[model samples]
Target: MTAEVQSVDIASPIDVISEPVILTYFETLNAGDFQATADLFAESGVLRPPFDEELVGREAIAQYLAAEAKGMKFQPLMATYGVLETGDTEFTITGKVQTALFGVNVAWNFVLNPDSQILSVQIKLLAGLEELLNLKPGQDKKKE
Candidate 1:
């Protein structure tokens, strides 16, 4: 007998994301199209992931995501928009990221240039130190 695979449908948070470029970033990243995700950024865009050195430029961003973000899904829940003193468009999205082994809440702060291309994305984990320390490498958790 063959085992049937089941697919879970997670609601798209595109409506909550007001910025077009930011919407595309989540869409492409969730689709596991690393290169496409990277292409949303400007030529000198930066990705600042938690606990790591910033990945600078599209090539580095694509390569890093390809290596680390496979099987990861981002579910954005809320967004706050603003403008920096430098006049760049900025926004922060709070969401949960589901990985094969576990899920964690995260906030992504995006900075966009005048042309709507990504200037930088800074990701911060919302988990407490105790919560983060409790996660086991191979433990599977139900998607919340």
Candidate 2:
């Protein structure tokens, strides 16, 4: 499924996001460990995508992720651009994402329960690719 288009302030300064849970989320996804990824969430956790239907509960979330992993081919190059501490247990992470098809900016808003389990996650699309997917903004042009 295609993600909804989003608008982001690209000029905002990007800060390094070094959250362990965030890192594990990406790592598990990239590794194609759908169950492991779902295990990171709380039993009744929710996964909200930019375009697709929301998946709630561990079983539903795992099933969705498993299906996506089976269907999609590309792995994204994701870089954390910023993060906001929305509350004591809630945070939002903004990042630049690139894959074989296109590049996009995205945000992952997460809520964690007392046990550090992810209680909910909302994935938002921020923007589409403006430059070539393989060439990051400041990179030099390839020699002819």
Candidate 3:
């Protein structure tokens, strides 16, 4: 059997997103624990997912995450994605994503600052998602 689908808060993956972190934020988003994700963000950090406005700061991130939690369910898939240490204070990560809320598959290349805390998050959804996914601009299916 596949991993049982469950309702997970998108922010729930924060704790597990360690250095060279591999996370499934979108996949884990449920009804609770979003604040946990926001907390992992640097104070002036931002999360940009294509079309939507950039969500900056812990407060704004919390609001965005909370809204996501209320609107959809998550099932962040586990894959052996890798990370690139592009800079002394930066890391780039790539991985798969799926959520009942999104109805599609996605990926993200998160750029974390040297502090090992999230600074900016960029998102992408694989091509097949255009038919069903409702993510932001760059992450939209047609582009991916």
For each candidate, what is the lDDT?
A: 0.86, 0.63, 0.54
Model 3 agreement with the true structure over 32-89: per-residue lDDT tens digits = 6677677677899888875589999989988887775465544443322233445423
Which regions of candidate 3 deviate over 4 angstroms? Answer: 1-31, 71-102, 128-130, 133-144
Instruction: List pairs with backbone clashes in candidate 1.
Output: none
On TM-score, the leading prediction is 1
Model 2, 24-113: lDDT tens digits are: 776777677889889999888999987799999989998988976543322223333222243326656666554444445667777776
How do all the candidates rank in terms of lDDT, highest first?
A: 1, 2, 3
Worst 10-residue lDDT window for candidate 3 reads 1-10
lDDT of 3 at 108: 53
Model 1: per-residue lDDT, tens digit, 16-131?
Answer: 78688988999999999999999999999999999889999999999999999999999888887776667688788888998887888999988888899999999999989999
Rate residue 131 of model 2 by lDDT.
40
Q: How many pairs of residues collide in model 1? A: 0
Q: How far does residue 33 in candidate 3 sit from its true spot (Å)? A: 1.1
Q: What lDDT score is found at residue 73 in candidate 1? A: 95
lDDT of 3: 0.54
Which parts of model 2 have CA positions greater than 4 angstroms off? 1-18, 69-88, 128-144
Score residue 97 of candidate 2 by CA lDDT: 50
Q: Report model 1's TM-score to 2 decimal places.
A: 0.85
Our tally of clashes for model 2 stands at 1
Deviation of model 2 at 86, angstroms: 12
Candidate number achieving the greatest lDDT relative to the actual structure: 1
